[model samples]
Target chain A: MTDATPTFERSPDLPPPASTVGVVGWLRQNLFSTWYNTLLTILALWIVWEAVPPVISWAFLTADWAGTSRDDCTSGGACWVFIKEWFGQFIYGRYPIEERWRINFGSIILIVCAATLFFPRFPYKLWVSLFLIFVYPIVAFFLFSGDAFGLEWVETPLWGGLFLTLVIAIVGCVFALPIGIVLALGRRSDMPAVRAVCVAFIELWRGVPLITVLFMASVMFPLFVPEGLTFDKLLRALIGIMLFQAAYLAEVIRGGLQAIPRGQYEGAQALGLSYWKMMILIILPQALKLVIPGIVNSFIALLKDTTLVLIIGLFDFLGMIQAAGTNPDWLGFAVEGYVFAAFVFWVLCFGISRYSLHLERKLHTGH
Target chain B: MAVSSEVGTPPARASFWNDPRIRAIIFQILILGGIILFGIYIVNNTLVNMESRGISSGFDFMGRTAGFDIGMTLIPYDEASSYGRAFFVSLLNTLLVSAIGIFFATILGFIVGIARLSNNWLVSKLAEVYIEIIRNIPLLLQIFFWYFAVLRALPSPRQSFELADTFFLNLRGLFVPKPIFEAGFSAILISFLIGLVAVVFIARWAKRRREATGQQFHTVYVSIGILVGLPFLAGLVTGFPLSWDYPALKGFNFQGGMTLIPELVALTIALSVYTASFIAEVVRSGIQAVSHGQTEAAGSLGLRPGPTLRLVIIPQALRVIIPPLTNQYLNLTKNSSLAAAIAYPDLVLVFAGTALMQTGQAVEIIAITMAVYLTISLVISAIMNWYNKKMALVER
Candidate 1:
């Protein structure tokens, strides 16, 4: 005694929920749904208003973007003129005037190679990156140091500014990674004696602050060397930074190594590969891949730590600024100098972190 | 008693070339020998070079007078103080800044972390900007910015910016009214301490009651009342024995009040702001790691939002939060060494910088300084491990 048949027509689609359909609805739900949320929204807007406009006006509207000296900076705003006047020094440091072209060429090669390496669609990416990793440093060293290419010699002491910072960061990472891998392996080795030595070395470096290490290198390293052999302060700082960073990198690498399944090791052994060959060919590739984000993070940290070299009398990028800030010629522009330095560091670090995040997402193996 | 009585033939002796155990021993011995010989060679060279330079190395300089004046000291110190006292004073200063930094940073970090998770679009975005900007810049630069660019821009002590007429800010530093304890003040202190203990007991009792009888108690209000009322009552009985020592301009600088030097202020602010960004990320991740299913389950069980967070979420989230939080604290402690950059007279500045420079005992001074940091790290990690275990989940 039910109805003979049901209606075949579809029910009309209702409008989407009112709280999520439009911009106003979105605003209502997201910003002003509750009284407390509304208050927070207003406070946030006020902060933005109070902060952004002043910064814009100070940095752009009243900024002195022209002229060469401080006289051009009459406006009550940022003195971009001062930055421009010392821009050359900021980039080339105390490198000889005739030899600035070598630094420029070196930087140009670096930028081009880096751009090509990171370019997603670039051909021969592997070979290019390999070249960058292995050969470019040697070539760049000759270009910067000279005396081998019929170019004038530029001492390490003469290196400064962004060039020196990049040098330290790149060289430090390159040298540290292999040492870190070795130490990480040693820490995980079966032999107790090797493990103990590795543990002591890593901990000894990790326990102290980087500054004391630099101090030791500067003040005590000279005493450790034989007579008639002296280390450049820059060399000394590099060594100190390398040892310090290797400890941190070893820990990160160790974490990656630990993530590898014991089955992987067993498989490699079953293939009859020797221990070193197995690690080199099988274990490390996957472990390093897993820890790319961590490695990038440590590299960023090392890049920032290079500024500590200023304490060792090494005139790196930041050291140049600290020195130039005190210069009688550029008095009262410490704020500008520091702001520039901060901006440079922020950009580099932020870029590296963003890349790391991207790599992390891309390399999600779901293990 | 159940051991097998069957005897088996021994395996053939393995050759040394193919033996893993023998190879390991040989490898270890080689490493040990190399390390020792290299260590001796370096030591010999260092000693010879140091002697040639006429710079003797030992920790005996610790007892000698420091002669240098520290910018800030927690304990009494002067030019006449021994190097040991100076070291202690600087260590205390370091701990003081680190403690203050950690306290404020945790509070700010939690607020920012929660704000980041706020449904309010503007609030979360603003929090994001704060974290990104603060975290990207180096800590040393941030310290310099606060010290030279912001705090140094303040008016001189003679024209100090007064806050509530009790706190003053100037180029010299921040000056706040010192709390002066007078006769019978110990009574109020004792009452406060008693109130704290009572609150703990009340909390435990209330929790037990809630579990046993499905009843709720307003322990928060009760505890606050007890804490405040007991202190007030004790102070009244003790004739209100607290006074404020106001700072006054006697000459060029302020006199007769507690002064926090600009260096300390800058260092603390920089450390707090820099470290708070990191802590904020940790806190946000910790809270986020407590899955939404847990909250849903709590809600289905008739738990309100506050109880769901307090009783359900926080306990689990804290397990995730504490390990990283401890790391940030240790990092802040270590980063305090950057105080040497601004001449804040921290342990590094006092012991490693000045003490070493004066005595020319690089090896000894740096060793002690490094040992102190290592010890601090070890002790902190030990405490953190204990706390983590206490907070860890109990599973079969």
Candidate 2:
């Protein structure tokens, strides 16, 4: 009966209090909000202070970069001259100077092909990828190990450094993928015998370390082959790496296979598609899409594992550095050599991982 | 009518080539046959090759003397030790390094993992950088860096980097005080064992009491107190029968104290640091997997942050964390083979490298090495499967 006409008017929201906004507020909230946080902040700062400057001085500020020999380094810091001088060997190993152009050209083709495949807007992605997967390896093999086209033959032993590292990683992953897919399929097949064989193969390779596998390839493998039919050291190492990586890849693919819903299988069966047709046309595409991150991760692991070939005496990037560091002329430059190798590897791996993360984000369809 | 008749009766038999079951059988037979033939070929070739190369194949070489000196060993090993003994020595060294690596990696991993999720910006960034840098670089490179660049750069024993005059760091290796347990040390050890049993009982009793009455007990504090206090009391009563064999500078090298060879140090550091990166990622993902709603639920129930974490969050997180954490452990164990690169005299180095070289028994030696690793992998995977089943969510 007596409704009051008076009402309160809402005012525009006031800006947050000064103490709870901007830079100071941010610092207080993130770094010194609690007693322990403040203590940790101080500790972290002290650690950074203690560690960062000396490294900077040693690696950059006082380091000798523009130099030709050990004598040219006089700043009492890292002799980066060692890395600069041996850069060629670190990259191409003992690859002949004239033949280095083949490596560069092949790698350029690889980069272009890879770019086309990864580029979302590019047309003919499938064809480019097929070329990369099938044709490029043959071309690269002949190009690098030239016994044709009137080019001088560069034996596998002469293949070392980053060039050899990439060769092993690329070849290993490319070959392992098909074998891994087959093994993964066999592992999931209805036939128990097929499953058993696949399981044994995968487990046998997965169980042992790559070093032991390479050792077997080097020493024991010759015994396994026919007499007088010797294999190249690098070829043996490559085969060992491929088989070992395939097992790991198979496991990853199996995970992807398992993640596929049973409904997908039922749907395929309802369509009266044969098993091979169903898997090839329907299941694999979806499953592989779901596990691109896993595949890329396995590839990254394979790349890092390529370093194990060095243990068998094939001079990969790290091996070349190890060799160079021991050179009488470059004595005491191990630090610089290692730093350079670490940086190169870090760049490659970190770049690939970042790309994988990007792809993961891009492909994250709602479940 | 025809369709109905077909449905009512069994369908006509498909041709043998088109029969799924028949196809499957044929395929499996083909595969099995191929594998068998391949095996036979390999064996025949191996026999011929071995004969031609004069490389005898057998386990007889295991009994022969290993005429190489292991730079580091857990047991008595010299040029005269049998290859079998050398294998055991190397195996022990592998286990020793792996144990130490796992312990340090777990600790560092957890800390970094927690820090990665910390509210502090700089701390999280630092953790991220550490994980990224450590993981991206190949472990072998890191080992080389530590062994050749850093450790080898240290001054000689004459100019050792001394810590409290008991620990010495030089080009030779790390020389630390070795604990020498005397006569009455057994009393302290017995007390520790007793304390461990007491803690288990106390923990069980506290849990039962908490269930019976809605009250919490200070189980952790009490258990820790007992565990530490019992040993200290025993030591005090027994006059602390322990001594440290302090390293002293001898003519040109360190003497007395136990020496950790540079190889071991480098291997351990490289392994722990490298593996800690992966473990950190596993832990971060695990903790993140436990939904935030659980925290709020615990808060609503009057639980504090610490108890919420220990009782509510971590238990769930562990179900996700344990499988991957154990995988990392297995990876670390396998990776310890990299010690061969640095001449650490690990299994692959001593048995697979040196023994195989000396005996020319590549097949036997490599086979044995592979089998050992396979056994390890199988055992670990078995443990992982058990743990996975146990920790799996038990839903109605």
Candidate 2 docking band: high
Top DockQ model: 2
* Native-interface RMSD of candidate 1: 1.1
TM-score, candidate 1, first chain: 0.93
Candidate 2, residues A230-282, lDDT tens digits: the string is: 88898899899999999999999999899999999999999999999999998
TM-score of every model? Answer: 0.94, 0.96
- Clashing pairs in model 2? none
Q: Please give the lDDT score at residue B77 for candidate 1.
A: 94
Q: Which ten residues in a row have the lowest lDDT in candidate 1 chain B?
A: B1-10
Residue A97 error, candidate 1, Å:
2.3
What's model 2's interface RMSD, roughly to a tenth of an angstrom? 0.8
Q: Write the per-residue lDDT of candidate 1 for residues A1-367, one digit (tens) a residue.
A: 3677876899899998887869989899999999998998899999999999999999899998998777888998999888888877787789888889998898888898888867789988998888888999899989999989688888988899888888899899989999999999999999999999999999888877888888888888988888668979888888988999899999999999999999999999999999999999999999999999999999998898888888777788888888888888778888888899989999999999999999999998797
lDDT of model 2, residue A298: 89
lDDT of all predictions: 0.90, 0.91
